[model samples]
Every structure is written in structure tokens, then in C-alpha cells.
Target: CNPIAEGILMAHQVDWLRIQAQIKLCEKGRRTGITFAEALDSVITASSQKSAGGMDCFYIGDTKEKGLEFIGYCAKFSRVMAEAQASGVSEIEEFLFEDQDESGNTRHINAYRIRYASGFKIVALSSNPANIRGLQGKVIIDEAAFHRNVSAVLDAATALLIWGGRIVIISTHNGKSNPFNQMANDIRDERYGDSAEVYKATFDDAVANGLYERVCYMAGEVPTADGKEAWYKKIRNAYGPRKSQMREELDAIPRDGNGVCIPGVWVDEAMRPGREVLRLALDADFVHQALYRREAYVNDWIDRELAPVMAELDPELRHFLGMDYARHRDFSIICPMSVDMSRHRDVPFVMEMHKVPTRQQQQILFYILRGLPRFVGAALDATGSGETLAEDTADEFGHNRIHQVKISRAWYGAWMPKFVQLYEDGAITMPKDDNLHQDVRAIETVEGVPMIVKARSQDLKDPDLYRHGDFAGAGALANFATLEVTSGPVAAKSRRPRQGRRITQGYA
Candidate 1:
């Protein structure tokens, strides 16, 4: 229904609405020489149509000429913004340009900070500025909540903008507690009465009041539905009225900023013979590479402090390594971990297990290839540049099982659940080795899901019900039977599984 309107808007040639403002300013000025303040009021009044939505979309224009007129008006207003500077405590204008190109190239843009009387300047931003100065001008930060350093936005703006008496922060957000929404709410509650003119409104608020509806209607910009009705009438009846999800998002944040991701609700990783692996996870950051390194929680701590009293399986099984790759030589890493294990010490023993240089990638891979003589698949973690490297290595060594690794996706769908169940069921055991323990601790769960890999028989469980460790070579031997040659981006292997065949055997 909205396709045609979107198509038209996409092809809109001008900013017509602005042209009207220009004419109004000219006529008003002819009668009474318009002051910058008067011009500011007129511009705000003209632009404040709730119907036009946040940014201009539709207006008085039949052919593309009207669009061009709108563009001219917008440009003119921009010029006014570019000119109008320090007014008696009220900032007249400002503009910010920040975004990526169509091809995903990042662009650095300068902020235009203009004061009517005091000139303007552009400086490189180490961090986004919410306020360049106090009485002169301010800025509206784009994505306030998702920013890693949201505090930076507040510190800059509140220091300058609030003292100046004017501010208009704007954004379309997910919900409350989103830094912007929270700030807006705080302002709404008179928390910042001394600061600025804080008004929080969405595009919908403008549309409902007929302030911007004409433009919105013309452009087909309307609120989206929550989802389709349920298949059963009962389900539909149970479902409540449709609402924007912003409210729901507000409910999840920790009010107390102690860094506890989730409070009170603890995960239950109790003993269950057939479902032991509680969570299988992986993470790239080396700082917290060991899952036990630290978080405000208790997964690894339990394995150390309580695994003995829980499932008591620490040896007798086979352990092998699971590796996800990277493209560049710098990022490519190999972490050697043990399957059928439940402690950090065991992980450190499986040879070299640190994040090493790129030069060692092929050599370590060579050692792995030699150990697991049979064709063992590895995720060639490379997008474009890495792909070349992976292909070259595979060709040079005649190793063709180089699967393009999408580490996150595979773990989410395939590995996590299995890992959790294995932990819960006592399907894994660890040896008395540091490397193995560290690697196991390194395993991070994606969305609370575990990345379960294959293990071999003869797995051992401690009598104390604490640790579990399996022999390393045994795991590779078991997994070795399941592999088949599947080259880059192709379907999983061929007709018959190439069980028990060396990777170099296919040299023909």
C-alpha cells in the first residue's frame, strides 16, 4: 500500500516547504523589517507542523518543481542556521552531518557551530559534542543510547547548553532508559528546569495533531503494527492492544548501575545425567577470554567452587580443539581447548594456546593437520581479504576443507544447545591441566546458549562430582570419521562421508 508513496518520496527532487517560509519571511519583512528573533519564531512556527513529521517529507508540490522549492527553502533555512548566532540567551541555529556512505565507508563530518554575532568554527571530534558552547549553540546527538560512551554526550551538552537556556534534543528511539528518552523524561519531570526548553515528541505525536499529517499521509509514513493476529481467536483475545515496543525496552534495564546484567535470577546448572552441559559459549575478547575471568556472576566459579560436589566427572574422555578463524594475520587466532572437561587447568596443557602472531597461523595449522592426518574441517574466518589468504593456504597445502566460518551464526543455532545439555547431563569431564581449564573457561555462551563440539568415549568423571576431562587425541579421532571435503561456500561435503581419510590423500 505504501510502496508507491515511498517510491515518490525517494525520488523527491526538492525541499518545497522551505520555499513557503522564504516567501512568508519576505512578505512579513516588507511590512516590518524582520529581526533575527522574529525570523526565528516564523521559521519555527512554519517548521513546527505536526503533520510534516520530524524531517520534511511531503508538502505543496504537484510536479517535481514543488520539491525543488522545498529544497530551496531548507537550504535557505540552513543558511540562516549557518548565520544566526548568539541571541539574548537563545541560540538561533546549528547542523550536524554524520553517516556512512552507500558502500559502508565511514565519513567524518564537521559540526557547524554558528553564533549570529560571533563567527563559527569546525574542529575534529575525539568524541561527539552535545554542546560546543553555552549561550551560542548546541547539538542534537543522533544515537544516544546505543553509544558506548553515552556519558560523553551528557557531559558536553549539560555543561554548556543548559546554562544557555535553549536545547532541542531529538531522536527516534527504542524506549525509556534509552539515554535520550531518559534525559527527555528527566527534563519532562522538571529535573533540569534550570537547563533548557526540553520537549519530547515523536513523529506520531506530530501526525495525530495534524501538525505533519498531510506530509506524512502523502509520503505514507505511518506507525507499524506490532505483528499479525494470532491463528486462534483465544490467542488474539489474550493478546493486548498494539503498542510501540519502547515501553517494553524500558522494563529490562538495571536501575542500579552496579554492572550486574541480571539480578536475582540465577541460572540453574544442576546435575542431570543426560543433560549436563549447561552453557557452551565463545567470545573473542582476550581480556575475559576465560569465562571465569570475571563478570558479576557464577558459571566458572561454580565449576571451581562446586563442580566437585555436583557431577564429579574430570577425566577418562577424549578432548580435541575447536577453532574459529579470522582473515588478517593480526587477528587470526587459535585457542586450544579440551572437550569432556570442566576446569581451566586442563585447557592450558594442549600445546600452544595463546593468541599468537599471524605468521604462526599456517605453521600451527600445519601441526594440527599433521596430528589429525584425516581431513579435519576448519572455519577459514575471512570475508574478502582473508578469503584470498585462506584459499592460498588451502591450495599450497592441498587442504580443501576450508569452510568459510561464520562464528556467531553457527554457535547460535547449532553448538550452544548441545553444550548446555551436555553440561547438565554430566556428558563432559576435565583433566588436571591449566590449558584445558582456561580454554573451557574461555568458552562463552552466545545468548546463554552453549557451543557443543564432539567428544570421544572413555570420558572420566571425578568421584567428588567436580571435574571432567577426556584425552585430547581421542576427540579428534572421533570427529575425524565425520568429515568430508567441502570447498569454499559450497554445500556440506559430498555423497559419502570421507571417514578416516587423510586430507593429503586427495592429492590426485
Candidate 2:
């Protein structure tokens, strides 16, 4: 190896990254020299003969400028190691390539290419380019977490693996929910069956690997241990109070963004592991049938399923319920929250059901309200298909006891902060469920307002669980209910009379 190339590989992080793996993924700190080291590896691969396992390399970045910068590293590696190579790196060239949009519309792109003395070459590509699907070669996706469609890019990259081409994915996390972070985690957990190699390098890891000393060296100053420590401290201090940013960018910790409605740390802290929790699972068909003939099946369900669970709750504590209604596609999350006002702890009990009829949901909610020792207030989602059920619940419970919440940008903008404050102040506790954790993380800030992602999907085998942020929405509603009942509890209203308002509506 050339001295420059050898020096580049001398970094411990670089050495870890250089291990020969067909599928390589790196969760790295920002501004570390991992990408630079990757460029040297690309040079070595592209400059070697086919008999030596060399292949044409494709470098994809989040932007064309990043492509240029990566190619610049390759150019430097070529210059410093030309005599050592059997097939030397040649001059960089600019060319136009025809690229296509997602809609099959064609456009020309200015791409940078570097040809080695061997038949192999390296090309730099912009993010999410459709033309990548048409290419067959070793793929290097840089800053994958920041790509517009990282999942789609990964799909394209994996296609090349069938032909024995390699794939290298590297980026710091953008959010906890980003596909790149999830894939890296899956690989680390051995979900991919040990074919892939995983590399994790945080800011601290790079610093221990001589990152600060290298910075001093790059600045043309003699590197010292004390000077390196000072530089590291100064860099970390620049991100004060924005701990999520620091964690995501430097610590290699997964963070959705600053606008996430709830901090993942808070959720983790609030989890009551191994605690007894109730989950009532009901299918759509059974719920629908039970609703029409409530005396036959629905009543039995409440007694058999809901009653035992209700009995387990703390009888003395005041309870409030939040219901986000969805009949199909998304789960209807009903969160029953108990507040020990004296202790100032809000313990939320999670109940998620999907594809259940609105009538069964109403019956379930009615039973929950009737069984509670002290029912403060309930907030029911009244958006779109939820309107009828919400209104029915409100009519049954009265305006004093039930709030028919129609969610909007203004609604989330005003109330989400309070919900988040409950988490930040350590006033909330939830059950230990990974799906619920993901729901909390799915809430992102868009244009200074907090909202759940519209197109977000959870990777669950259950199609009903493929919701954006059902639990988060219900959690927010539950928090909102606490604000509605300030002084004391109000009795639920009824249609006929307090006595006649049980399950029978006297309907034909």
C-alpha cells in the first residue's frame, strides 16, 4: 500500500471498516474519516485487475456536491499511490448521463467519473437516482440516512448482490425511525443471517481513534493529548442542550429529529417492564356481530375480557380514557390513564385493537367508563371516519365527561407541547412495548408544528398494526382529557334516563 493510503488505513475506525465483507453497513459519527477511507478502498478495488476481485465502483451520495467531494478523495489517493498500483488511477472526467424520474420522465445528469488504468472505473451519483436500477456494479451509498428515499436506494443496491457485486451503506442516523438505522440494527442483531458486516463509530470512538489528533495534524499543528482533549470538549460544547442532535450526529444514537413529540429516552425511562398489563384482542367480524346483538356476545366479552382487566387497575386513583378511532387500516388505540394526583404520576395503560366495528369500540369504551372508580374525562378522536363514534360517545358521556376532539394542525400545535412536557417532567409512565415506542418516535415536527408522519409504516407482520402514530395520538388525547376536568368528576349523560341508559337502546 502507498504511504498515504497506509496512513489513511491506520485509523482504528478505518481498519474496522476495511474488513472484507460483501455487505457492509456503518453507523458513523459526522465528519469522521470513514468516508475518506472508503474512497481509498474504492481506488484499490477499481485499480486492480478482474482476477484480483476488482469491479467498477458506483458512489452515491445525498447530493452531487458530496459525490464530487468523495471523488476528490479518490483523486488524491490516486495521485499519492500511482507508482505502487499495477493499474494506476487516471484523470477525473465529467460526463452527462441520462437519468429518469420516479414517473419515468427522462433528464440529463452531470456525473463525475474516474477511470483506472485497468478496464474498471468509478462514478459518482446523486441521491435516489432512478438510473441506479439500470446499473450493475459494486454500489457504495454514502450518507444513506439522509437520502430522500433510502429504502428505495437500498432495494436498488441489493439487486446487484445477485451478481456477486458488493454493497456498502454508511451514514449517521437522521432519526430513530429512518430505514437506514433500522437496517443497521437488524444487521447488528443478526436478523440478516450473518452475511452482512456492521461498523459503528461514534464521535467518542473516532476521538479515541485519534480523530482530534488528526484534526490538529490537518491544521498543520503538532498534535498533543491535552490539545486533542480541548478540541473535543469545544466541539461537544457547541451543541449544548440539543442532546438529541449531539447523540444522533456524534454518538451514533438513533434520533428522529429535534421535533419528535416525545424523547425516546423518556419513553424508555417510563417503561414498566414485566408489569402486568391487559390487552383485549377482538377481531373485526366478531366485534361487528356482537355489536348488533349486544346481549348475546358483547356482554359476554366485557365480562370475560374487560372486567378482569378493569378489576386489576388501582381503584382509588382517578382514571381518564383517550380513544383514537379507526375501523380499518389503522389500529384504534384506547389508552386508559390513571393519575395519582398526590404523587403526580400519570400511568397510561395501553389497549390497541384494529378492524373492530365502531359499535364494539363504543361498547368497550362504555364498559371502561362505567367500571372506573373515578372517571375524570375522555377525549375521542372525531376526525374523518371517527366522527360518528366520537359524537355517540360524547352524547352518551355528555360534554362535561367527554370531549369529541377533531384533530388539526392547530390542535396538535397547541396541545402537543403539553403532552411532551409530561414526558420531559417525568410525570408519565407507559407499558413496555416496542410498537408503542415506535409510535412515539414516529411523531415528527413539520414546519414548527408537531404531527405524526402521514406515510410512515411499521414493520410488523400484522397489517392492522401498520399505522403511523396511533398510540402517540391516543396518548396526546389522554393528556388533553386531564386538562378538561380541572376540579371534579361529572356524571355521564344519557338519552332516556340514567337508569335506562345501559346497553339496550330499544332499537329495532
Candidate 3:
């Protein structure tokens, strides 16, 4: 039957069927009808002639019940189309499916099948078969995230593409660390080279396309606006207090370990174009040159890049600074935050230094600190090599104004949430840059603490370089400074007491 003309298929279902890619994946919400759409597609494919792209279809669900459900859909659809097409569709046959492994090990799996007159059949395996490569056709893996070995199943599915077979993967997110979520990310990041595509369907997206109405019709209840609202609320409230789980299951957002702490959309919304990200890279030989030469080289860079950006800061606003320090490999990031009357934090500019000597880094940092209008306080990363710089800066600018932060898990637990809160509350804005975007996206939850992950992404501008969330750490520290540091103008302090004699008081 023509489900589309009958309005049986929703927009997302139709859109899914329209994609004829070799490999397509759907990361969807629970009960979004993706499996139902796949069942119809499987029936049509199995009924088509060989010249019209007919082939055997395999449905691999995580459990036996799911297999039965899929096979039932195929049976129903096949019988519906039989009268119109005059095709012979057989009854659902329960039999043993022979599965073989790479080592020639063989086993029998419980399977259900529906044969068609076109010599093609649709088979639903009760479990993930070891010999997926052995059956070549349109392979549909449902609830892929719940599979026993997600990575192994995905790896085997790719082999079907060699024989012009199409593969379809559909599931709701399990977690950020699940291979299913990772695969979706890989496709978005273009790791699959356009061979695979990922389609996302959240609960809200389905409701927008008449999911609630469909539910009402199925339940034989009249649909009303208030009823739909209450239905949505009921479903959301079902997972009360478990916000992460609710978001993952209903919103298609992945949570738990290794899940992205800051989504790209949030980062994109907070990013303000036209802001500057000053970069200074010094050669190894440049550091070995005479001290004056090194000083002059960095000074020129400061004048050309940093001076213009700092000149625009408002003197009336209180400013704070955070620095994540590095000497050679990773970037030493400096983030300066300006707080306005509305309590919004605006990062006027970000400064990144690579392969620069300690003295030069100090020179650039001190310049930015001094140039900042109404500078209140600054936080510096004091871990390892960073200690010397943090200490020196504290000594130069008063201990009360410069905080020496030693980053640790406890520290992250205390401060990272506040940093994340800045973005969540829309209280902060930063420069629009791809490298900075990658840096912020690197923050992931580990053991219940939010911190940067060990795995790094390559810099978009420089292929040879990688980022370890330097900007994110610095931004976090800068945010910490704003909360901890007393807000006001900083009093200038000299290195030494005045050597000259002091004037006597009038009374003396």
C-alpha cells in the first residue's frame, strides 16, 4: 500500500526513505517510528525485481523480542502490498540461520523470514549474528547502541558496502562513550568521507511532525492541544531529577563519561565574531639569541597584535585575567575577561603563545595586565613549569591581585562547573575561532568531574599542531578569578620601597 499517500509515514520517516546512500545512520529518540519505517522499506526492497534493486534484507536487533517485532512489521507490509502488485508473499517462517565466523566456526541462530515472488526475502535475526558479512543485502541494525559489541557490529557492517549493499543504523543515544555516539560524531566530523550520513530525530522533533497525533489515533483518543502538552510533560516528568537521562533519551543528547561538556551549538551561540585571537610563535633559535633581541622581537609582535585589541577595553569595567601556561608543546593561553554593569563577561581577545621563552611570556602577559582597564585580579596556572611565572607575576602585581592556581581534580570539581555555568547562563562571550571552538569542545566529564580529555584534536589552521583545551582551561580560570577576586580597581604596587626621604607631617 502507498503509506505516504495514506499519511501513514511522518515527515522524518519519508525523509529517511528518500536517502539512498550506501551507509546511513539515524540517532533518534525512543519510539520515534524509525524501526517502523525501516520495516516498510525492507518489505519494498525484498519485493522489487533484481533489475529494480531488489535484494535480501537482514534485520539485526539487539534482542529476540525486537526481532519478532520487526518481522511482524515486514509480514504485515508484505501482505498489504501483495494484492496491488500481484506478488506472492510467504508466511513468516521460523528457522535456524547458519552463522560462521572468520575462523570457520559455525553456529545456528534463531531467525524469522518472509519470502517474496522476486526471489528476495527479508530475514530478522533474533540476535547479532557473527556472520553479518556472509549475508549481503540491506542490513538494518536497530538499537545499535544497545548491541553487545557496538564497535564490532559497526566494523562488520562496513563490509556489506563492498558488494553494493546498503547499511542502516538506528538508535537512541546510550552515552557519550558508546561507540554509537562516537560513530555519529565521526560522520559529522567527516571521518567517513561522505560515504555515511547521520540523521538525528529527538522527541520534540517527532511531536512537531505529528507524533502526538499519531499516538492519539493509535490509542483511539481525540487529540487536543492541552492533551498534547500534558502528554509531553508527563513523558518528560517521568524521569524526574534525572535530567541527564531525560536529555539523553528524549532530546538525543549523549551524557555520562567522555560526552562533550559544551555542545557546539552553545559554543557557537556564545562566540562573537570580530573579536581578536592574538597568536605569537617564536622559533627555537630566536629564544637562544641575545636577551635584548628576544625582547625586541616579542615587543614588536605585542605592538602589532595585542595593542590594538587591548586599546578597545572599557576603562569603566572591571577586568580579570586567566592564563593556562605552557612552554613548548601545548599552547600558553591568556584569556582576559571584562565584566560590565549587567554582570556579563566579555572576552575582548585571546592570546596564544607557542615556543616562547619564559621571559618573553612574562613581557607579553605583564603588558596585557597593565593595559587592561580597571584590572581587578588574575589567575595563572601554577602547575609544574607554570609555577615560576605565576609566582613572579604575583610578586610583581601584589599577591592579592594575582592568584596562583594549581589545577587538580578537586579544583576542577570546584571551579569547572562555574565555568560551564557561564556559558549555560549566557553570561560570557568569546572570540569566534575554529581552534578555540575545538579547545572548548575538548572538555568532557571524567569520573564525575568535568575536565579536558586526554585525546586532542588537530588544529584547523595548523595540521602539525594539536590543542589540549588550553583556551577552555584558561577561560575557566578567568571565570574563577571573577568570582573569587574582589571586584574593584587594582592598586599599583612597586617592586621596592621608595629610597628617597619622606616628607614630614605638619604636626611633627
For all predicted structures, in order, the TM-scores are 0.29, 0.52, 0.53
What are the per-residue Cα lDDT tens digits for candidate 3 across 58-121? Answer: 9998778899999999998888899777789999999999999989998999999999989999
Best by TM-score: 3
Off by over 4 Å in 3: 1-258, 492-508
Residue-wise C-alpha lDDT for candidate 1, range 314-432, written one tens digit per residue: 23432233343432211233322333334311122222222332333454444443333123344443444445656655674455554443345553355434443333354443334
lDDT for 291 (candidate 1): 29
Return the number of clashes found in candidate 2: 4
What local lDDT does model 3 show for residue 73? 91
In model 1, the runs with Cα more than 4 Å from the true position are 1-74, 78-136, 146-148, 161-165, 194-198, 211-213, 216-508
Number of the candidate with higher TM-score, 1 or 2: 2
Full ranking by lDDT:
3, 2, 1
User: Model 2, stretches more than 4 Å misplaced?
Assistant: 1-6, 86-88, 101-104, 256-508
